[model samples]
Target chain A: MRKLVFGVSAFAGLLLACTAHAQEITVGFVTSLSGPASSIGINYEKGMNAAYAYKDEVSGVKIKLIKLDDGSDPSQATKNARKLVEQDKVDVMIGTSSAPGTNAMMTIANELKVPFFAVSPVNVPIPADGHPWGVSMVQTPQLMVKVIADRMQRDGVKSVGFIGFSDSWGDLVYNGAKAAEANGGPKVLTNERYARTDTSVTAQALKVVAAKPEGFLNGGSATQAALPLLELRKLGFKGPFFGTPSLLNRDFVRIGGKAADGTQVSAGPVVVTSQLPNDHFAKKIGTAFHESFKKVNGGEADDGFSGYAFDGWVVFLEAAKVALTKAKPGTQEFRQALMDAIYANKNVAGTHAIYNFTPKSYFGVDERSLVVVKLADGKWVYQP
Target chain B: MNAQIAAILAIDGIASGAIYVLIAIGFVLIFAVTRIIFVPFGDITAFTALTLASLENKQMPGTVGMVAVLAVMATLMEVFSLWRKGALGKIPAALFFYLALPLIPAAIAWATAGTLLPTPLRLLLTVAVILPIAPLLNRIVYQPIADATVLLLLIVSVALHFAMSGLGLLFFGPEGVRTQSLVDFTTFIAGTPVSGQAMLILGSAIFFSFLLYLFFNFTLYGKALHATAINRTGARLMGIRPQQACTIAFLLGSVLAAVSGILIAPVNTIFYDSGFLIGLKSFVGAIIGGMVSFPVTAIGSMFVGILEGFAAFLSSPFKDVIVFSILIPVLLWRSYTLVHAEEEDEE
Candidate 1:
């Protein structure tokens, strides 16, 4: 029932109700906010809210955000996507925070011919079969190899060992880490794998610890991969433990504690926006984010998941505004114009960073999007 | 390898072996009683050690305070049990509640205190918490399941485990935790580094196993409980309260689980999901020990640990594969032997 004009991303057409007069445009914001992953999804919502705050009102006019909660369920995400496209009649839709859930809607968007933008997990498999309507904002697993390897090589790490989970997700990151490490310094000493629910990892960790490697890499979700870190420390492997974005999960810190301290790797840093490279917009944006996030979450901003989702709404609204100009007010022509505007996007500063979407390539990563960040004192601080 | 290297490897193997023995004892206790393999038993180590670590909260400072927490837990169990129907329902309900949010209070407590209490006290405190509740579980869950097939009982035990695990993720969040307490004292004696915590765990396992053996064989109460375990009907015919004996066995089994958790928590960081793994491997240790004898079970668990340790040292990559490969074959061979032994005894 809530109407956010580029405010919250709801399903389908809650926003489509706006252009009835051809006066304003609406976008649906879909993200998980009540499930196990809700807290993380809330971060994405914040980004959308801040972006919607509208300094100059660049996205055609005042935006209304139609918010939909997917609850981190893939089926629910599909239902929400359908709702946005049909009932809410949103001009365009933006944001759902996970890969499986994102992929579910990507298929729906492709079938329905709607644009879908998201943040792909850093170590997830590359969708070689790209969807026409799909554009994830972060670096894909294929490109992450160069970024991680370049950083590890710069840090002079050689002779790495890998502990991977025995699954496709693990394999994707394993291949990425291997490819990344191939061009560089360290020879891989060992690679061990386990089934998803396998709890006994001491033996596997022992293999890496005894190898006397410079550092170790684990490839799995936080729950499965975390056990070995403590076991390795027990067996006297004092070297750094590293992974891709999976390491950035709060569960890792919660699970591993002091064991997680010396660990370092790459992911979207949970940095205050101002601490970024630029002093002007970055500082103001970061400060606003820190204050707003603390108030909303009773703490600081997490990895800006909700914030980025919010930015996705910003993109959808911008395109909707321009779409309204090209198309007859309430027809499907509005959807096409919105899609064209999104595809034509080159540069727009988002809470996560300057957004870039091209007709050719939709993702924003190109060496700068992801950088090395260490888990120090239970919070992220830049390494590179 | 040189003698010094051989010695260090032996010592490392021995220490790890000790941890396996404690798991074995819990396995022996449960298997000896109802022949039902209880998976939630392993979580005793996960949550108990976590509780121990949380006890030195800024608010609480001594054995008295720790005891008070135990009392609170008992009262909560009673209330939750009452909600479930009566005292009998408390078993599953209490465990379910424990699984869902076992670590939140502990996490909050740990975050506030900044450190855990002394190691020995932490271990003892966990035993104290579990000891008072074991009899209650037997009176409710295990005693009723006594007449059922071992397989059916196992299914129920596993169901209880699943419920607990689901709750753990639902409440405590799907995260693991490390025991911040000083678990191991590492020393490089003559150039070979060894984990002192591993030694303590092994020694404790052996010591406890021997004490358990003496109690079961020499004490009247223990014999009555054993009689009840051997045959509930026969124990009742002999004028022993089968109900009280069942309570005793459950208490004894729970105490064993609590002790094992305390010992193993130092070996691996305790997490909610750890219970099943702990229970399975420990039960395996008991099975390898013949499922009837405490001494052998303790010895069996240690041996399993050493073999696992040796496998890790040898094949670093597929270490688990190697260990389990040996274990499965040995277990199959042993079952065949046990079957043959039974036939020969019949003859």
Candidate 2:
């Protein structure tokens, strides 16, 4: 009789909850899922997306996420961002694997008055000087480059040749190195510029070798950077070589062979999984995200750009949950409340790492969490 | 600053010039016989070098000669088909000709990737990959432009360059192969240390020139080729088959591009776009040497190469300015003489 009574009460509760239709919530994400930059964007997007679905349900609210391919072109990023806002009517936006595209999308978000979250945030201070609506999911180039530079300096590399990709991203890393000069570090022996499409880096490598620099720090995508690695090895250049996060890929191990062993790359050293193997709170939420997202997307989970997408959705849900208390609050009130909540938000350990965005500190996170990773054997096995 | 320094610089130029000379020879040969240059010649060179490097990296067991032989045979087969179709006659010929040339470069690059080739044999293999392309070009783009002199040839050359550049960017993806040095480049001569690769390149250049000279002089085929170069219509009248000579010249031209590319692979990186600059410089060298004459441009290529080395070494940033310096004065002089002579040609 007691069990029967409890079943009837549960049925009545379900009936009561079905009284009114729930408002639709939308989240939009854009990233480079194709092109030469796929090495970074593809893996990143997969990881983030997996992180999103690891939830059973997003904060007691129904969720819908729409993803668009940005193609790694900055101009295309703007158009894609606008479509998500104007046509899709998304409540939030996240994107762009690389900086240029993401920056363009961030600018669009400013005009549209939409909240934007970034995946690959740099160590450079941007969102700090003025932008409040944006936050980075990954460590900045300044931090990442410094990690590699620190390692090289520790290795006693006195003179170095800096080979940079001829693009905005390349420029970003180069600027980071120049800033490090103030510390009175290694004397930069030479600087070489190579077009992104230059495959036969032997010529560029030859010129650098002629300078006889003891070390090389490359800033570019994997293939472009890999060519130089191959050239250096053939010329018997056994000196230490380092790269930005762009060169960090397991495929680099397969293609680069033994030559890749000593090669190092710097990243936020993200330790993302469906669940942290040990952290109890992380395991519970990660399990939910894994199961729900897999149910929706029909695959296993990964902490790719989708993680940002999910994170964007989570931020929105939390804000909406807080905002819902206003019973149809004004957009300003809701936005301000959300911003306050973001400021006060704490201990949000994410696959991309925990978010701690405050008003005054737009970055809201320590840059030192970044670490230098080396390729040992064939994987991104961390070096001490 | 001193005599020895100057001599060393000269030697550097000769070594550098040797690679360019071989590439220039193809440009000169095709220009002379078909009277229109093969614009995709550089792409062909990049294709071969990239393949050889990939092959070398794999440490696959093979002689570079075997690889070269396989490539030449395959290319020659295509040349015959183009010849049969008379694709060398006009637009259809050029269209068909361009289609056939890429197959060989692509094949060599794909098949031989990771194969270790002996250095001398590797150079030979490189020569093999490009050597057969000239004859094919004769039957395609070059021969069609034989009668074209003004905007027509220029348009054709530019168009071919763009197409080849695109395809080169596609197949090679702007990346070139990295080959190990067959000869040690780091060594000392007398009291001074000279780059060993530099000496090897110079030596290769001398050997290539001698081979080129012997090729132009003694062979029956060579005599017939010279006859056609002197007068195509007359050669046709004498049953020398001007068509055959043009095709042969194109083949010979392509071989040099391959040879030079493979030879340079061990010393420096060969890029997909390397051909355009080399092609341009070589064309300049040919013009400086005199278009109709053979050895003049080959010898002139060395002088141009030396100047480039000086330019590159002097200030890497201004290498382009230094190399083109020679071209500007030569052009102005030629134009001055041309306006006075009621010139029949720009060169």
Report the first chain's TM-score for all candidates.
0.81, 0.75
On residues A240-308, what C-alpha lDDT tens digit does candidate 2 reach at each position?
888877676444455566776778777543433422245434445445566666676676543334555
| Alpha carbon deviation, residue B280, candidate 2 (Å) | 5.0
What docking grade applies to model 1? Answer: acceptable
Q: On residues B172-243, what C-alpha lDDT tens digit does candidate 1 reach at each position?
A: 444454455454367777887667776676677778777878988899988887886676667779999865
lDDT of each: 0.62, 0.62
lDDT (10s digit) by residue, model 2, range B168-256: 55445434445666666567666454667777666766777787678779998887888777666777788898777877777777667
Candidate 1, A195-298: lDDT as tens digits: 54443566566667657789887776664466677667766688887777666667677767777786766665335354456543334545665666666556
